[model samples]
Target: MKNLIDYKDDIYKCSRCGLCQTVCPVYKATLNECAVSRGKFNLLNGVIKGDLILNKNLKKYLELCTGCNACKDFCPSRIDVRDIFIAAKAEYYKTNKLSFKEKVLNSYFLFKLVLIVSRFFLPLYRFFRVNKLIKYFENSIKKMGTAAKWLILLNSAAGNGYKPKIRSGSSLKKVLYFDGCFNKYINNETLNSVKKILAQCNVELVTKNFECCGVSYLNDGNIDEFKKIIEKNLSKLDDDFDCIITDCASCYDVLKKYKDYSSDPKAVSLSDNIKMAWDLMKNLEFEALKSYKISVHKPCHDSYEFIDLVKKIKSCEYIEVKDYDKCCGFAGKFALINQNISGKISEQKAQNYIDSDVDIILTTCPACLLGLEQGFAELKLSQNRQKPEIMSLYQFLSSVCKISD
Candidate 1:
């Protein structure tokens, strides 16, 4: 994985036709020659053929990508650009070494340690806008010569946000909520809404401490770190709950494909579980949900599975938008590291929904929520109009459905 020469053949297949440029969010945002796949491909090819060594410029080009898979989606030859970049990072880190911040971020023990330490300062941290302070810290770290500052900032930013109060209750069916690190740290509203929806279906929510799903690290081509975290997560489960649910599409996508030594049953996404639960509750009579213009933003990871469910739901009339599976530009750290490109991709998705005139835009992933909201807000600001509300499928269903004990 550390050898750049190994990918020479794989990368040689790239035609450099610039199809990737058309779909690349960062390229669209920065307009820099190096931000697009074509530019990165040329750089990597040069390195592989011994014309150039892995350098800061190469890293910058690699880092510009969000690993969102859009270029791969549109590529004629279907080269794995994201995976290739991840491999490049692993190769680069092997020789240049990871910074202390990256080393800490890459270490599960340290990451969890920071989360524990941050919890104690939650009130005061919120009072002083600690997250904003963290942004400055990361900026300083990057300025002080740490390549991993962006990663630290993302971890710190995720830590600064609100957490959900996991409701305690006794119910018939017990569930293990695989609260991915970010959802637990930042987007607790999604967790609460999911819990409320599950409760309506007579399900009890429970969770044991779980490790990061390692999808982010996987994108970095750190297979050792990815496998280490995956194993750590598998060990924490005692197998008491019937079903496991996750709200993050990326986490769900990763965990569903998780092949640990233990071979635990695959985890289900919250949307899939919700659709199943909704089917069980559909027989119960309830007043019709009010009709309103609504659009469903199906994330690329979960869109195929969710599309059928979208078609089957009766509560809200579904309005379809073109290219609904386009990446929302928030593939975890993609937007943070490549803000300009991410913003453009996000704005495009937002415009799709706005043009449809949907009252509420429903999506499943938290990243999509942020990307869509940011896009909608920017578009709204541009037009001097209001942005549409964003809601999760589970959250929307929980608001409308009635539960019978």
Candidate 2:
């Protein structure tokens, strides 16, 4: 429950050296000084000194950030820009009640509702060759609109018909699986893929009724709601498990921070066990089933240790494209708030992959998956040429690799 005042010293620590401008994706895309952390810090410093107002317009400026933390990582001050921005947003949320339209548009409940409804129709989306149909009409669909383009890409990914080998093995390590909202509601492809791989490794994949990782709530400065989700998730944990595993980078990032928001001592213990599923796979071996070229889009919040493991896969050639570590520009709600800027960043990123001409573009976060979809949708593909297929790191592996361990 720290306020913006708590971040005053952090704000003033900004040296105005503009190094943040070099790493910020939004600033790179928009070239707007206000879009970067150093610039945002300057405005915050003004507000702290009582020279400016923390008003709605100022909140809009804060919204420009994608919560990528690139600047925070590169800053000499090591300022936690994400937390400062959240504190500032919370300060505004204290007085600025959301309008009904804003509430509905940003509603987590509605977002879940949409996913639930989509899940309901998943059988039909797949039964009728929805993915192939979309592929067949790619050029025409591109003209429908941006949302349509993103829909086709994301939906095609889930139903893309890549099947992993079903393996049989005995259980050994006990790990609770945190199936994120994307895997739980929209599609189980990633979850199913993880389960299959772990099964081969003789790992007992435990399940629990864990809730969303509260990443959206935290970034929006809805700390109250974020804390509720964290506590709810913590209440589900115990010492019976060796560790907690998640495939989604965003979920892993937020789960690892649960201790920062809660007073219940269990939060610390559970957070200590937060892990990417790749941790278990690091010891296992995989036999490559394809000779395709592949590359990865590292999620902003990912542990990212899996990159080396991926490169180690025998037959898949890993091509390191330029700015492989840059943001995909779909920092969750940041996309909704700044669509033009977000699209520009994502499209620029997509062009990199297109230029590399890799067969697959892999990522860890579901939101980043959508950002890729959004980016490619903005492109006009050459006739008879399709963009590279997108997949979760594990999802692609499950299809192309078998645990030889």
TM-score top scorer: 2
Q: 14-129, model 2: which lDDT tens digit per residue?
A: 88899999899999988999989988988988888999888888888998999899999999999999989999988877868787865775576887788788777776777788
Q: All candidates' lDDT scores? A: 0.65, 0.82
Q: Candidate 1 at 267: error in angstroms?
A: 12
Q: Give the per-residue Cα lDDT of candidate 1 at 210.
A: 75
- Per-residue lDDT, model 1, residue 172, is 76
lDDT of 1 by residue, 39-154 (tens): 99899888887897886557767888766678888999898787678788778777676767567656767767766665555546667775567555443343342234334434
Q: Which stretches of candidate 1 lie over 4 Å from their true place?
A: 1-6, 99-175, 199-205, 238-243, 256-288, 380-384, 402-405
Best lDDT goes to which candidate? 2
Clash totals for all candidate models? 1, 0
Write down the RMSD of candidate 1 (Cα, Å).
6.9
